[model samples]
Target chain A: MIPALGLLLGVIIGLALQPTVPLWLQPYLPIAVIAALDAVFGGVRAVLDGIFNDKVFVVSFLSNVLVAALIVFLGDKLGVGSQLSTGVVVVLGVRIFSNVASIRRHLFNA
Target chain B: MTQIPQTPEDGRDLDVQPSTRTAWRRLLRAASPRPTKGTLLAGVLAVALGFAIAVQVRQTSNAGLEGLREGDLVRLLDTVNQDNSRLSDEIVRLEVQRDELATSTDLEQARAAAQQRLDALGILAGTTPASGPGIVMTIRDPQAKYTAAMLLDALQELRDAGAEAVQINDGRVGASTWFADGASGAVTMDGRTLSRPFVITAIGDNNTLAAAMEIPGGVSETARRMGGDTTVLIRDTVDITALRPLSTPRYALPENQASPSK
Candidate 1:
C-alpha cells in the first residue's frame, strides 16, 4: 500500500514540476528507468517466495540503474550507444516478464 | 445399471474441501509475504522510478528527436541551415530594391529621361519650333532665272550642312515639303509661290552653313551664272517658329497590335 501510494505521489510531483532533462543525462534516463523496473519486479517475486531481503533489494536496485547507465555511457564513447541501449532493454524486459510470471503463479496457482 | 459406483467417497471429498472465502484469504496471505524494513525503502525507490519514467516519457513525446541517431540529427541541421541561407538571400535582394525605391533618385532619373525623350521626338517630328546660331541666304533673281529644281538642290545642300530646321519665305521645310514651278514661271515651294528675293532661314552651325553655300560650283556660283546673285549672313539666333500640324497615320499600325484594320 505504501509503495503504491509513493509511486502515485511521485508521478504527481513529476507532472507538477515538469523538470527539463539536461542534454548530457538525456541518453541515460530511459535506460535507468527500465533497470529500476526490472529490480522492482525481481523484488516482488522474492517477496512472494518468502525470501525477501531489504539489503539485497536496495543494493540490487541502485546497482541495476547504475550499471545500465554506465554501459550506455561507454557505448556512446565507443559509437554504439543505440545498439547497447537496445541490448539492455531487451535483457531487462525478459527478466521482468519471468519475474511477473513467477508472481502470477504464486497468486493464482494456474 | 449395474449398481453404479455409489461409494461414500464423493461425499467425503466434498466435506474435506476448504470454503471459497478461506481459499481467497490464504492466497492473499501468501501474496503479501512479510512486510519488512525493505517495504519503506521499496516505497521510496518506487517513487524515484515512477517519477523518472513519467519525466522520460514526457520528454520523449515533447521533443520526439531524442531517439534519433547522431547522423540523422546532423542531416536535419544541414537542411535547416540551407533553408535559412536561402531565405536570408531573398531578404537581402528585396532590401536592396526597397532601398533604391526609398531614396526617390530612381524616380527622378526616370522622369528626367522621359522628358528628354519627349523633347527629342518633338523636334524630330517638326512639332516644335527651334532656334540656334544659323545662316540666312537671300537670292536676287531680277530676270527670274532660278528654277524650282535649282532651289531644291540648294535646300538639299543646306540639309547636308547639318541644318536642323529650315524655312523658305513663310513655308516650313518639313519632311513632306515639295518644290514646283507655278504657272507664272516662278518657283513655288509646297504650293506657295515666292516673291523675288527668296529668303531662306536655317538653324545650324553658322560657319559650316556659310562655307557650304560659298563652295565652288555650289548654290552661290550657280546663282551668279544664272543672272542671279546670292548673299549669306551669319546670325547668333535664327528662330524657325513654323510648326507642322500633327498628322495621324492613315494605314500604318503599331507592331504590338494583333492585326491591322482593313
Candidate 2:
C-alpha cells in the first residue's frame, strides 16, 4: 500500500514539474527507466519469496539504473548505441517477465 | 520441514544453490504480512521508477518527429525546398515590376518638362503669337519728316518698358529686326516700307507702357517736336498675330558642333 501511494505521488510530482531534460541526458532516461522497472519486479519477487532485504533492494535499484545508462553511454561513443540499447532491453525484459511470472504463480498457486 | 533461504544479517543468499524442487518449496513459503523496512525502501525505489517512466514517456511524445521513416522526412524536405524556390522567384518578379514603375514615372516627368521648355522657347523666338495688356501708338508724320532713327528710338523705349511682344504695321519685331530709311524718305523695317501714319503695338503693362510714351522729353514729346503728333491708346488686350519665319543659320554654327578647323 505504501509503495502504491509512493508511485502515485511520484507521477503527480513528475506531471506538475514537467521539467525539460538536458540534451546530454536525454539518451539515457529510457534505459534508466527500463532498468528501474526490472529492479522493481525483482524486489517484488523477493518479497513474495520471504527473503526481501532493504540493503539489497536499494543497492540493486541504484546499480541497475547506473549500469544501464553507462552501457548506453559507452555504446554511443563506440557508434553501437542502438544495438547495445536493444541488448539491454532484451536482458531486462526477460528478467521482468520471469519475475512477474513467478509472482503470478505465488499469488495464484497455479 | 523444508528450510527456506533467509538473508537477515549479511544478506548473503548466494551461498545456497537451490534446485527447482527447493525453489518451488521457497515460492510456497508464506511472506510476512506486516510492513518492514525493506518494503519502505522498495517504496522509495518504486517512486523513482514511476518518475523515470513518466519523464521518458513525455520526452518520447515531445520528439514525435523521430518516429518518421526516412522517405517521409526526405519528402518533407523536398516540399520545403520547392516552396523556398517559388517564393524567391516571386520576390524577383516583384522587384522587376517595381523598377519598371520607377523608371516609367521618371520618363513621364522628363517628357512633361521637355514640352514646357519647348513652349517657352517658341514664345521667346517670336515664332508664336502672344497677347497681353499694352499700348498702341499711331504716329502721324503728315510732314513725312519722321526718320527711321526716331521710329527705332520709339521701339527701344517700348522694350525698356518691359514689352514682351511688339508689332509695327504688318511686321513683328523679333531678335533680328532692323530699321532703315526707305527710298521715299519713309521708314523701312527689315526691307518692308511703311507709309504716312506708323502704327506700333506693344504687349506689356498698360500703365507703364503708356507712361513711357507720355513722359516728358519721351517718344510722344519727341514726335510732336519732329512735326508729327503721336497718339498712345492703352488697351487691355493687344494681340500680336504676326509670326516670324525661323531662318536656318548660314555662317554661324553651334559652338559644340562647329568644325575643329574653323
Candidate No. with top lDDT = 1
Q: Score residue A75 of candidate 1 by CA lDDT.
A: 95
* Candidate 1 lDDT over residue span B214-248, tens digit each: 99999999899999899999999998887777787
Fnat, model 1, is: 0.52
List lDDT for all candidates, in order: 0.81, 0.79
- Show model 2 residue runs off by greater than 4 Å: B1-37, B64-262
Chain B TM-score, all predictions listed: 0.55, 0.56
The whole-model C-alpha lDDT of candidate 2 against the native structure comes to: 0.79
Residue clash pairs of candidate 2:
none
Task: Write candidate 2's Cα lDDT for B1-262 as tens digits.
Answer: 4444443332333454344454555544423233677667767777877776777778777876453334566898899999999999999999876666467667776577677887666666778888889888999888888899988889999999998888898788888899998776778988989866989999999889999998898899988998989888999998888888888889999887875642
